[model samples]
Target chain A: MVWKIQGVEGENYLESIKNFLNQLLKSKNVDAVLVPKRFPDGNNTAQVLITDPGKLDDIDPLAPVQMVNSAQIVKELTKDPVKEKIASVLRPCEVRATIELIKLKQILDARLYIIGYDCPGVYNVKDYIEKLEKSNGIGKEGFTLSYVNSFLSGKQDTIRESCQLCTHFTGNSADINIAWVGSNSSDVFIEVNSEKGQSLIEGLAGEKIGDLIERNQKINKILDERKKRQENEIDDFLGFMQRCIRCYNCREVCPLCYCKECLLKPEKMGYSSDRYLRRATKKGQIKMPVDTVLYHLTKINHMAFSCVSCGLCEQACPMDIPLGRIYNVFGRKAQALFDYEPGRSLDDELPVATFKEDELKEIEDVKE
Target chain B: MGKNSVDFEPKIIAFLCNWCAYAGADLAGTSRTQYPSNIRIIKLMCTGALDPTYVIKVLLEGADGVLIGGCHPGDCHYINGNYKARRRVAILKSSLETAGLESERVWLRWISASEGVYFAETVKEMVEHIKKLGPNPLKMEWAI
Candidate 1:
């Protein structure tokens, strides 16, 4: 059933969401709530896990900036067996990443009520800060509302490239999707996609309405615009690799890069200085911080199938590599080879781990 | 062909599974089967143990080609190692293509331990094919 959430006493959509979550806390439906909130400075937002209902006053459910994928934090919260339930409000990509983590065994069996929202794309933290400065103290929540207005009308100017290309913005894979794309101004549509979501909202928030809201038409329209833009910007990854200094920031920020013992470590890369010099001697020259291409290729090989195309890697790059596009394009291709979509469900087989004894015949034989 | 092109003897790194291709290559030596001398062999317990990183390393390090030889289907010494190797090889090739490298330079062949003659012919064929593709472009590019 669809739940229509309207702010009590004429509050806006952002404020309305805060009220709903606070209701959940007050009613004792969940032990803790994980949502993005404005820092005490009132200019920026980051995710926080709150236990007190009073602390839910400044929550921002779908702000226009994301500093992390949030799945990494979800993993930390759930890795050890937990009895208390967590209601995590996440973006579409974070939902997908969380599912991948579950399949990767990063998240153990933890009770989580995943609340996803229709993300209107996010700005890179740097771009968001620059826009905030020009907003003239409209405040973080106020600045975020302005962006949502443009997004609803299909006039979003500058979001991260990965968000622009994202087809899964609604996060249907999530338990619950908070929708607002087609709604009039401050009304929120609570869409329950799974049984778990239905149970979480059993006796909470707004009267149960039989009428459902459809985000498909608007979502498809934005995806069409994004697909067209993607065709025009097929930039060369090699050009970006030349500028990569091997800081491994892309790997560091990736939610799927959960390996505790990374093969990319210098010791596991296992290159002695003597071997390094010898390789240079043989090649006549070698790039410093060696294995630049090797590291990237190996990383993509390792985790491309599980990649959620979140663009955190691109945001993390100091040299401004278009790693978001590079990884998404390549990851989609890798996934296509096996006809596997990461995080679609818990039952789908991982591309590398399990294989049919009879499938993938073409990959075996080399052409003459 | 230009004199330099004709003189180009492509360097090939062949990863051979010990129970099959490694033994097959050894059999070819004892059987006096003639193949190109360009191949440098590395043996592993199984093709599944051959991490794709090793293939990327040699290709980036300027080897002209890579050949991974294992038991034919339903014949892996480890039952499913060859099947897993096929998937890794596919992923590795996809990675190479995405990086703008020539993926055709890498080959995966199913050769049994008893097929000494078949193993020799596969090497000769790989060497000739790589000769036409020329040296790996990564050989001269210092930026990696």
Candidate 2:
């Protein structure tokens, strides 16, 4: 919208988020704003539930800059069946994860409201600070918004290989999509992607944004450049990932990884305490992480139709494995098979759990 | 056909409920009805006892086809096991195809205690179709 509203009373992105939380708390309808807080050691990211408006002042939405798919947390909250509507600010992957969870009936819809923003990118908290220090000689403790924004704007050194290729740079399916891709002179592209989004737009009572044809075209060009860059990075990632050390941080950080008893569980996987021993034995002698490929394949079998490509897995890797691109490549194939896009529609059934008679005729013919 | 070619023999596993499907197969045997011997039966207390993994693992282990024959929807000995089994198997079949496995490898059918001929004929048909496909590629070396 062409609203002349300052993001904060006087501050920038940080102040704007703080003000938004303040407004949310004073509003009678909102009960909570589920959020993430900067940890004490500040080495990793942790999710938190924020009820008090005072805590909003210290909240750092952009700190750590690590991506998380928060679908699981939102899905868990929705099942409470509360009368009070809850609001959550989420990453794009989190929104997509919630959509799949809603479709699976694991979560309820009416109880939650979502706010999403265009993702500049996220870092593996520790890796981000380390890289910032190494690249610019800025100490790890000195990293800030100006540092991150300069890097994201590409005025600084390039972003991680995975971030460059991310296709969903803009939020497409959120209730209220926040945009900051335009120049300081041009107005922000505040697009309402749904009925709830439109309501939030009305509630703001901001000046209506004129159709941003030229601005949108410019954004699309940037996105196209990002896509091409992502494709090359994805290729590099897939090849590099063959050297994985099998840390499960990627699975842990992923918002959509909500399997309570995933196949990797000891009871299900048969890989007991000897997991590392087996890997050591198989290292170059045979491919270690015996079912690394199978583990991914099984997950894809179950959840590819629901994958949001949040890329937290790649960010969370200690070994710098690009799990997100590996997933997105297969996810793209699986999504295309059903002609369905994750997070695009809540009413659509996950492709794995639903079938049509005409869908696999090629397999039938191949059988003959 | 090559001179050394062997006649196609399908390997099929049948999970028959004790109440109806088992009786139906028994009836077929008593009547001397000719049906495919490719089927090896596993009797379950109820068709609902059949695990979804059993259907998938058997296919992965080289069974050309699998059949779960239970009591008609309401006629389960355990009240509603067959219905639950139906829902899970239907979901599993779709999921298998999505994973690049063929869905036809898993099939679900209902057989009453009186439907001896139907059980026999269903097996015969499944065996014939699977014989044409030979073996599951997931079990074959060609599968990536």
Best by DockQ: 1
Question: What are the fnat scores of the candidates, in the order listed?
Answer: 0.63, 0.01
lDDT of 1 by residue, A1-368 (tens): 56775443225778767777877777777889999998887678889999999998778866789999899989888877788989899998999899898888898745888888888899999998888889986767788888888887787668898988887888678888787776666677788888888877766757766654355667778889877766322366677788889898888889999999999998887789898888889878888878888899999999998888999999999998888988888888888888888878777878888777887777665676
Model 2: which docking level applies? Answer: incorrect
**RMSD of candidates 1 onward, in order:** 2.2, 6.8
Q: Interface RMSD for candidate number 2?
A: 8.1
- Candidate 1 has a DockQ of 0.63
Q: How well does candidate 1 score on lDDT at residue A101?
A: 88
Structural similarity to truth (TM-score) of each candidate: 0.94, 0.68
Looking at candidate 2 chain A, the ten consecutive residues that score lowest on lDDT are A357-366
CA shift at A193, candidate 1, in angstroms?
2.3
For candidate 2, list the clashing residue pairs, or say none: A69-A255, A165-A230
The TM-score of candidate 2 is: 0.68
What is the number of residue pairs that collide in model 2?
2
lDDT of 1 at A32: 92
Best by lDDT: 1
